[model samples]
Target: MNILVAHNYYQQIGGEEQVFLAECNLLESYGHSVYRYILNNDQIETTPPLELLGKTIWNWDVYQEMRSLIRQQNIQIVHFHNTFPLISPSAYYAAKAEGASVVQTFHNYRLLCPNALFLRDGKVCEDCLGKVIPWQGIQHNCYRGSKSASAAVVTMLTTHRLLQTWNRQVNAYIALTDFARDKFIQGGLPVGKVFVKPNFVDPDPGIGEGKGGYALFVGRLSVEKGIDVLLEAWAQLSTKIPLKIVGDGSLASEVNRATQQLRGIEWLGRRPMDEVYKLMQNAQFLIFPSKWYEGLPRTLIESFACGTPVIAANLGAMSSFVTPYETGLHFQLGKADDLVTQVEWAIAHPEQILQMRQNARTEFEIKYTSSESYQQLIKIYEKACIQ
Candidate 1:
C-alpha cells in the first residue's frame, strides 16, 4: 500500500512526534511505500498572527500540495497524526478530492477542546466537549493563553464541523484506547468509524532484569501530571523508597525544590531515548500520576515492554492498562495518601511485585508488540480503504 503520512511537528518534541515517526517506520518495515508531509511549529514565529489564524482554518498550500502528492504517489491511505494551526483539516479534503482513504489518529482531543488536553487550571475541564463552537475555550483563552488564538482554533473547529469535514472527509479515526474511543464518540465523532489501537514499542526493547532498586517516573513534570501529589506521597512514605524522575516541563523548579528537601527523590531532567530505555529496563517499576484523561501514554507501554509494572493513577486510559493485581496497580487520582499506601504495599510484597512484572511483560507481548500493532493497523487501513 502507498501511504502518505502527514504531521505538523510541535516545537517541543513529544510522544505524538515519536509515535508519528514510529508508525511511519512500522509501515515501511512491512514493505509499504510511505511518503511524509510534515510541517513544524517554528514557522509560527515568522508567520503573521492574522495569516496564521486564517491558515489554521484552511491552508490552501497544504491542500494543493497534498492533492498533488496523493495523485502523484497514488496514495491509498493518508494517515494524519496532527494538523492543528497549520496543516488544518484541509489535508483531509485534499485526500478525498484525490480519491484516497483518510485515516486520522486522535492523538489528543483537539476536535472536542481547543487546548486539546481538556485541562484547565490544573484540573480536567470538559466545558467545550460536545459543543459546536467551543465558546468556553475562547472565553477562557485556552489555546496558548490568548483569547484571539483560542478564537482562531474555535473558529477552525466550528467551521470544519459545520462543513461536515470531520464527519464526511475522514474515513476512519484511530483512538489510542477504548476509553479515548468512547470519549471521542461522546465528543461527536462517528461511532463506527472510531477504532481503538494503542501505541506499541518498536524493535522490542525486550524484557529487562528489573534489578534496579528505585522506582521510576518518566513524563512531563507538570501540574496535570500530579507532580505535587507524587512529592507529597514521597514525603509521607515511612520507608523511603528511591524515586528517580526523568523528564522536564513547566514544573522543573518544583521538582528541583522537592529533590532538595526529599531524600529519596532524584530529578534527572530529560534523557535521550536510549538512556530512558536503559533506565526503564533496570527500574523496579514506573510511576504514572497523571490526573487528566490521556490517550494511552507511550511511557506506560515502554514500561510494560521492559517487564516493569506501573503504579498509576486510576484515571482514564492509564486505568485500562494498569489492572489491579494484574499487569500493575493503580491508586486514586491525586490522592497522595492512596499513592503512598499503594507504594508501601508494592514495596513490601516483593513476590507479588515480581509476579506483576511477569504479567506486564506478557501484556506487552500479547498486545503492545510492534508486530501486533502492525496487524491491527493493517486491518484499520483495510476498513478505511473499503469505505
Candidate 2:
C-alpha cells in the first residue's frame, strides 16, 4: 500500500515525532511505500501572529501540496500524526478531495481543548470539553498563556466546527487510550470515527534484570510532569534511596538545584536512545509523575518493555496503563505523600517488585510489540478506506 504520513514537529523532539518516524519506518520495513510531509514548530518563531493564525486555520499552500501528493503518488491512505497550527484542517479536506482515505492519529486532545492537554493551573480542566465554541479556553489563555494564541486556536476549532470539517473530512481518528477516545467523543468527534490504539515500543529493547537499586525518572523536568512533587517526595525519602534523573525541559534549573541539594539525586540531563534504554534496563523501576491526561507517553510503555515496573501517578491515560501490584504501583495524582508511600512499598517488597518485572514484560509482549501495533494500524487504515 502507498501511504502519505504527515506530522508537525514540536520545537523540542518528543514521543509524537518518535511515533511518526517509527510508523513510517514500520510501513517501509514491511515493504509498503511511505511518503512523509513534515512541518516544524520552529517556524512559529518568525511567523507574524496574525499570519500564523490565518495559516493555522487553513494553510492553502499545504492543502495544494497535499492534493498534489495524493494525486501523484496514488496514495491509498493519508495518515496524519499531527496537523495543528501548521498543516491545519485544510490538509484533511485536500485528502478527501483527492479521494484518499484520511486516518488521523490524535496524540493529544487538541480537538477537545485549545491547550491539547485538558490541563490548566496544574490540574485537569474540562471547562471546554463538550462546548462547541470552547470560549472558556480562550478566556483562560490556555494555549501558551497568551490570550491571542488561545484565541487563534479557538478560532481554528470554531471555524472547523461551523464547517463540520472534523465530522465529514476525516474518516478515522486514532486515540491512544480509551479514556482519550471517550473524551474526544464527549467533545463532539463522531462516535464511529474514533478508535483506541495504544502506542508501541519498537526494536524490542529486551527485558532487563531490574538490578539497579536506584529509582529512575525519565521525561521533561516541567511542573506539568509533577517535577515539584517528585522533588518533595525525594526530600522525604531516605538519603540511601538513590534517584537517577534524565531528560531536560522547562524545569532544568530546578532539577539542577534539586540534584545539588539532595544527596541521592543524580542529574544525567539528556541521553541518547540507546543510553536511555540501557538506563531503563538497569533501573529497578521508572517513575512517571505527570499530572495531566497524557496521550500514552512512550516512557511508560518503554519501561514495561524493559521489564521495569512503574510507580506512576494515578491520573489520565496512565491510570489505565499501569495495573497496581500487577505491572506496577500507582500513587495518588499530585500527592507527594502517596508517592512516597508507594516508593517505600517497592523498597520493602523486593519479591513483589520482581514479580511485577515479569508481569510488566508479559504486558509488553502481549500488547505493545511493533508487529501487533502494525496489525492494529493496518486494520484501522483498511476500515477507513472501506468507509
| Top model number, TM-score | 2
Leading candidate by lDDT:
2
Q: List the residue pairs that clash in candidate 2.
A: none
Q: lDDT for every model?
A: 0.91, 0.93
| lDDT (10s digit) by residue, model 1, range 1-387 | 999999999998899999999999999999999999999999999999999988999999999999998999899999999998789999999999999999999888899999998999878899999999889998999988999999999999999999988899999999999999999999888898999899999877888888888889999988878898998898876246889999999999998998898788899999998889999989988989998898888999999999999999998898888989887889998899999889888888889989988999999999998899999999999999987
- Stretches off by above 4 angstroms in model 2 are none
Report the C-alpha displacement of residue 333, candidate 1, in angstroms.
1.1
TM-score for candidate 2, please give it. Answer: 0.99
Stretches of candidate 1 exceeding 4 Å from the true structure:
none
TM-score of candidate 1 on Cα atoms, chains taken together: 0.98
Per-residue lDDT for 131-213 in model 2, tens only? 88999998999999999999999999999999999999999999999988888888888899999889998999999998889
